[model samples]
Target: MSRRTRRHITPLITAAGAAGAVLLSATAATAHVRVIGDVIPGKPATLQFRVPSELAEATTVRITVEVPKDLMVTSVPKLDGWNQETLPGAGGKGTRLVWTAEQGHEIQPAQSETFRANVGPIPDRYSLTFNTEQTYSNGTAVAWNQPRTGAEEPEFPAPVLVVDPEAGPPPGSAGGAQQPGTSASAPAPSVDAATPQPAAAEDSDSDSSLPLVALIGAGAAVAAALAAAVLRRRGARDGSHL
Candidate 1:
């Protein structure tokens, strides 16, 4: 291959490689479900569903999420331009609530839409599936409708709170078993206030001495330089007189 041809193709190859790397990085960065906030078991917590409007664009007009059956969701706040449908489960219990936010309700491109659900007093750990349907202005629907299988990679992963059994006695409450001569409150450390805290004093003293030492060294250097200059001038004067 000619040097001229190689030089021309080098930059093109480099540019292509860089573009490929950037594309791969962007795909990897966006390839997971992002959950915001801690998912505490048995406690009321707010969860925000963040959808990337960049990839879905105008195509995603509506979003739907399947609430976990185990979690006791007391209320879902009304969102503008969105409709809620609670699907009844067996025995008059509704296990799933589907929230549909359509075209006009859809979040703008490069923007995030948040839906809040109040859930609490759950007995066990459960996974809530967010099954989303994005309908474009072109009558095309893209379903971001995949259930989180616990094993799935997350972008902003919701924390799973582990509820452990309460340990021992409550605060300030005494148990039946008590050792003799032992007080409920632990003894405070005995500090010798009378003892001369020489370490701190020495440190302060050293810090103060450092400046004085530096001043002395500087004065000595200045004195020595002046003495040398005076000697040089005296020798020059004596040589001129001679």
Candidate 2:
């Protein structure tokens, strides 16, 4: 490459690198806490909270999440280096599950933890949102309780689960599938498309209207012509008699 081109390319490369780094940092900041598995509605499912340590100077000491009243949450997975507990919420209905670092163990900078729990009778709803707080050893706590979707998401947006409900039973359970001799039932086809019963009624109505219209028009024309003929015949009889 020419010397001039090299000088211009050097600054462009530096600018691109800087932009990439900013984008990466933004992604990491927004994805600090998220759900790891599918959130099924109307059933108890295993869920995981993916937590990442963001502070470079301190370790993450504790994490708390507000479980919705609709979801029944009780058990937490036994992590080797973490302790879990639940506290009373503002209302008597829900729970605030807290997971703290065990003795001599903390989530260091650039580290992450996956805390699992079986939480639900998940309501049949569109989404599940959890408000969370991540506390650092330096007493800094970051709150993640913001709207899930918009033109611009929050710095630490609340983790949301878009519920997906399948009609069949949960997987891996016995007797959930069709019998060996039977075929799976297809959805009943729409009556209009499959049977075409309504078309007959519509056609009947249309045929009835066409005959009525033609009869009305023919009757009107015959009445008008008959009136003219009567007038002419009356005049001719009167002149012949005179």
Q: Could you say which candidate leads in TM-score?
A: 2
Those runs of model 1 whose alpha carbons end farther than 4 Å from true positions after fitting are 1-33, 56-59, 89-94, 126-133, 139-242
Query: lDDT of model 1 at residue 132?
Result: 44
Task: Put down candidate 1 lDDT per residue, 1-242, tens digits, no spaces.
Answer: 23642233321112323322122236533643344546555567776666555442232354445555566667778888878665654465545555566547665555666667666764543334444443333333344544323334333333232333243333322322345666768875567575668798899888989988999999999999999999999999999998
Relative to the unseen true structure, what is the C-alpha lDDT of residue 39 in candidate 2, on a scale of 0 to 100?
Answer: 61
Q: 1-242 in candidate 2: lDDT tens per residue?
A: 23642333221113323322122244455566887566666778887889887766667777788888878885887888888887766668678888889877898777788888888788886567788887666555667776634345556678776675354343322224454555556675686777758869899999989988999999999999999999999999999999
Supply candidate 2's per-residue lDDT for 54. Answer: 74
Error of 2 at 195 (Å): 40
